[model samples]
Every structure is written in C-alpha cells, then in structure tokens.
Target: MAEAYLLEEVSNFTTKYYADNLPSVHNPPPRYNVAENESSLSLFQGQLGSASGATSKFLAYEEWRTIMLYVLTNLKETMSYIEEFIHQFWRRSRDPTSNEIDTLLKQGAGSGKPDFISWFKKKIDLTEVFGMEVDNEDARDEVDDAKDLQILERLHLDSDDDIPPPSDNLHDYVDMHDIDDETHEPAIIDDDDYF
Candidate 1:
C-alpha cells in the first residue's frame, strides 16, 4: 500500500540520487522481524513511519544533506554514543579512550572512506570483531609516508652535509635561467569587461 510505495520511492531515490552510500547507522538492530526474514523495504517503511508518522514525505536530497550536516556538526553527545557502542560491542578489550575516538572521528572527517576504515582498524580491533576488512592502499601509503619522514629526519642529523651555501633565498635553488620575471605579470583587463 502506501508504505510499499514509500519504500519503492526511497529505493529509487537512494539508487538514483544518493546511491548506496547509506550510513552505518541506517541498519536497525535485529528484533522480532529477524525471524520473519523481512526485506529492507518493509524495514525502511516501519522505521520511517514509527519515527516520523506525522511527516507527509521523506526529505529531499538538499534537505537530507542539510540534516546530515546538522547531525554530524552537532556531534558532542554523538562521540559518547559511539564510544559507548564500541565499548559495549568490543567488550572493553579493544575499546579506545574518548580522546582516541575523537581523533578517529576527526580523521574520518578529513579522509576518504578507506582512510576512515584504516583509522578505525588502527585504533581498535574492529577488523577482528566486526570482520570489517580495510582496503590496504591508503594504509600502505601512510606507512610509506612515515618511513619517508623517518629517513628525512635521519638526513637532518648530518647538518654539515645537508646544509647548503648561503644564498639570496632557499627558493633560489630552482633554475632561474628558464623563468623570465617580466613574463609573469598579471594580465591587463579592459574596464568594459566589468560591466
């Protein structure tokens, strides 16, 4: 009926506009419906209706984007909630401190999906507990960067060898013969273009 129609609409919207980038929070915990092996269409309608029965329609993409921003931006208590879940699910053996979780969240905000997964795996035993596999490319890049930094730091130890002769500026190391200083001037624009 109406519920089925709403779910079909959501599926279509998710497929066409949102794609499959559903948040991890979208999956509700198993309940009585687990025995019935109900499809996600039913689950979405049930969850949406119970949560927002008064609403006539699901949010538009812009509205959902705004809402997602709001949710992520106001993540003061959200950190605690995630920490509690991690602590409970992983059973304290692998749970990180609040500060660690905050660091992971910030890293997740800055990095792409796989970096986020790498951060989680690095901080906690998520791969073992959740059977979540982290894609290795970013992790390998991170390790390589760390090794490069280490080598650079070692190179800095031999200051006599690393030091260069005094010059006008360090940027003078670039080959100045190829660059004409006069050619780099800003373009002159006519006043008529402004109107």
Candidate 2:
C-alpha cells in the first residue's frame, strides 16, 4: 500500500508540474521551487529518515532538503522516461503498419510489455531511495493475481457452459406457414371454408 501511495504521489506531482508549466522553445526548463519541494517532502513525513546513527533516525532539516532534492531529481527523470514511452506508444498506435509494438510482445529477447512500474523499480531502487527496506514479494503477488484474473477471463470466453440450453417447450416454437405473408400476422382460420 505504501508503494502504491508513493507511486501515486510521484504521478500526481508529475501531472501537476506538466499542467502548470507547458513546454516551449523560448522558455527555459522549469526550475525547482522551494514550495514544491516542501510539499513533496511533506507527503513522505515519517518515511524519510537518516542512517548516520547506529539506528535509523528522522532526517534533520538540511538532510531532509538534500533528500527531497534527490527525490525530485529522480522523479523528474522518471517522468521524462514515462512521457517518452507514452509519445512512442501514441506514434506507434497511429501507424497501422507499425510492428514495433508487436516486437515488445515477441518471445525471447525484449519480450515483456513496457511496464512503467517495473521501469521505476529498475531505475530507482525504492529501498535505497527511501532509505528503507522494501518487500518486493508483495509486488510479485499482485502481478500473480492480475495474471490469474486474465487467465480466468480467457477461460470464461472460451467456454460455452455459461450459455443457456435451447428450450424444449412446444410454446417456444413458432410455425412460419401459419402467419400471413403480407401483414406478418397469424392467418384467421374459417371452419366453414375448411368443411
């Protein structure tokens, strides 16, 4: 849950930064702001700490500022990677003949889908970045659960068990000859004409 919260915080920060500051050839890259830094640090209250002592301790002001700077820098870099991936995906999806996306799904080298969460794990080791031990097993379990759900969905789609059986009742069947050809209503039967 903490990992999810951290990711959400990073994503929210990235979104707000982009929304507030639009890219331009004329203007310089967005400069880091003290208020923004403070806000980001505030989100991780007890999570940020120091390891200088025998036991971990809460970070001092200077230490916190330094750590927040590092975090922000990494966050910005990660956001850039995500933006690039999104742009690439958009470009690829627009081109009908593009098989570059299919390559990501191919077997062997470079197979797995482009997952930002995994990318984040690779780029920034949460344990080192946050100065705390992270349990990666939880992440693995979540992935397993997702795969299970997908497998179940595929199984459901392939099976015909969910479809109801055909009805055997006589009332359920209708005869086409009994209906009028013009109005498509049931023909009125006259007993005298038949006799």
Measured against the true structure, the TM-scores of the candidates, in listed sequence, are: 0.19, 0.18
Q: What is the C-alpha lDDT profile of model 1 across 1-195, one tens digit per residue? A: 999999877875565444233322344344432223344432223432233337578889658645553464365634543554344333245657767655544433332322232333333442453366432333234323333334334433222222223333323334444444787433455699898
Candidate 2 regions with alpha-carbon error over 4 angstroms: 1-42, 45-78, 87-111, 125-195
Q: Which whole-number lDDT from 0 to 100 does residue 107 have in model 2?
A: 15
Model 1 CA lDDT for position 75: 53
lDDT of 2 by residue, 1-195 (tens): 999999877865666446444543333344532122344433454334443557668999658655643564356444564444445344343543325422321211133333333333433453454366433333234323333333334433222232222233312224546778898666777999888
- RMSD per model, one decimal: 17.5, 25.4
RMSD of 1: 17.5
Q: What is the clash count for each candidate, in the order shown?
A: 0, 0
Q: List lDDT for all candidates, in order.
A: 0.42, 0.42
Residues forming the 10-long window of minimal summed lDDT in candidate 2: 101-110
